[model samples]
Target: MIEAQGLTKRYGRKAAVSGLDFRVEPGRVTGFLGPNGAGKSTTMRMILGLDLPTSGTVTVNGRRYQGTVWPLHQIGALLDARAVHPGRSAYNHLHSLAAANGIPRSRVEAVLDQVGLTPVARKRAGGFSLGMAQRLGIAGALLGDPGILLFDEPVNGLDPDGILWIRTLMRSLAAEGRTVLVSSHLMSEMALTADHLLVIGQGRLLADTPLNELIARDAANRVEVRAVDHHRLADDLRTLGGDITLKPDGTLLVTGLDSASVGELAAARGHVLHQLRDVTSSLEDAYFRLTENSVVYRTPVPA
Candidate 1:
């Protein structure tokens, strides 16, 4: 439903986004991830026609956003929750946005209820909290009932319950065959919500694959073995064609072989094994490890 080819964005001499190439297919939720200042937000803004790319082109549903006759109905985006006028009531805010695109007033109310902002529909947005403003922004995006949805950190300031709600909502939207692209810096949250991920670093594409595949590709398939004869077991496993690293907590970290093979070797050596299990790497750990060297800024540690 969305395609970008050689998309590049530059400001003065610095390229905020450089030659990004990807496609967001319909019927699946594509999670966009990157470190701070990695051009994720800039890229999203370009897709929404908020920023013009320096080179290449991006299209939603096979047409540029600006070229679409009814652009709001083709793609809905929530780039910033604070885009609404704080002085206007929630209902009036949506009504004004809806009228801009010639959308009916009923859509405003429908979307308000859809995003669970009906209770405060008449309240001034200036008095609403960040989470409430996020909901209002979401309501505005859904006002047109657009087929393609782009959410940039929809859960940024939300509570745990709001986070869960957005996750479920994204999945359901994709299940209904609508194109959904949600971006976040939280790898843990993305792991739970996204079926596929488009990871970027240094304004470049790093990896784009299924969530499970991304994890499995970088997963440290090591096993933690604790046995009565820890030293002896480590030595024996080293001879049996596996690398062993000793931990300070009286355990051996075994790699290059599965736990079952490690177990058999321990049994052959007459060693009593107390614990034998695979230690798979978490998505968050893998993400940090991959992006550590690409981070734009780092805080200094004082001695």
Candidate 2:
């Protein structure tokens, strides 16, 4: 498990992260999300003890990461895939890492196989592609078989199959009771892979809640209605409440009323209803709504 208490990081005049507080529990995947320049990487670095926070603290399993004995066996992190030595063979790279931590060399091969990098174990890391390097980094993370894992943008540069493989692997690790914290810009994938979310905007905690709860909370109360007389139905729905917009194809987009109410209004207005359904926000929609104002950088609207 991982916990951060008032974790704040400052770079001279800028605060990369401020007062970030959250917990990552075991047996579930906790996703960290934010827009570009939101201090996600800075926070991860603080957690790994790679960078000291200007203020506040972060701990893994109730102790600072640097304070733990055999820290590799307690927490495994794949923050950057390009951290490995380019000239070293994949096996040798992991072997050196394991030796540094007094871990068995056998773990090197085991993790290579676990991450599906057995054939490339003898290959030079410099020759490997980004996806392959990511797998090697993942293998190094698993070499210790730590109960706590942190993967930042694990699926970056991965193909569709590779993405699915990573998802299944992360889920399986959590299923085995490991505490997993992964960060990504891909909300759709996070929706499928993570059980809980820890959203941040401008280095501040936005929301830490169950996936379903976020969707339900951020989704607009709206209905999708279809009827035989589109114009008449749109007019009637507008009279009841809320603004309406007609899609390019046909259906009317309605807000401010539930699906049932939309149906009742349509029936009362003598409109022959063809289809009516509630339109709830997806995780992507909810994430955008939550972080809309917190994004650090934005393009200026052209005049």
Candidate 2 is scored at a TM of 0.88
Q: What's the lDDT for residue 191 in model 1?
A: 87
Per-residue accuracy of model 1 over 92-148 as CA lDDT, tens digit each: 999988888889998988998888888999999999899999999898878788899
Report the CA-based lDDT of candidate 1 relative to the real structure. 0.88
TM-scores of all models? 0.87, 0.88
Tens digit of per-residue lDDT, candidate 2, span 1-303? 889999999888888899998899999999999999998999888889999989898988888887566778988899999998899999999999898888998888889988888998999999989999999989888888899999999998788999999999999999999999999999889999999999999889999999989998765566788888989888887888857889987888888877888888877878887778878689998998789999778889899
lDDT of 2 at 227: 85
- Cα error of candidate 2 at position 295, Å: 2.8
Candidate 1 C-alpha error for residue 14, in Å: 2.9
- C-alpha lDDT of residue 245 in model 2: 86
Question: Once superposed on the true structure, which residue ranges of model 2 sit more than 4 Å away at CA?
Answer: 226-246, 265-275, 299-303
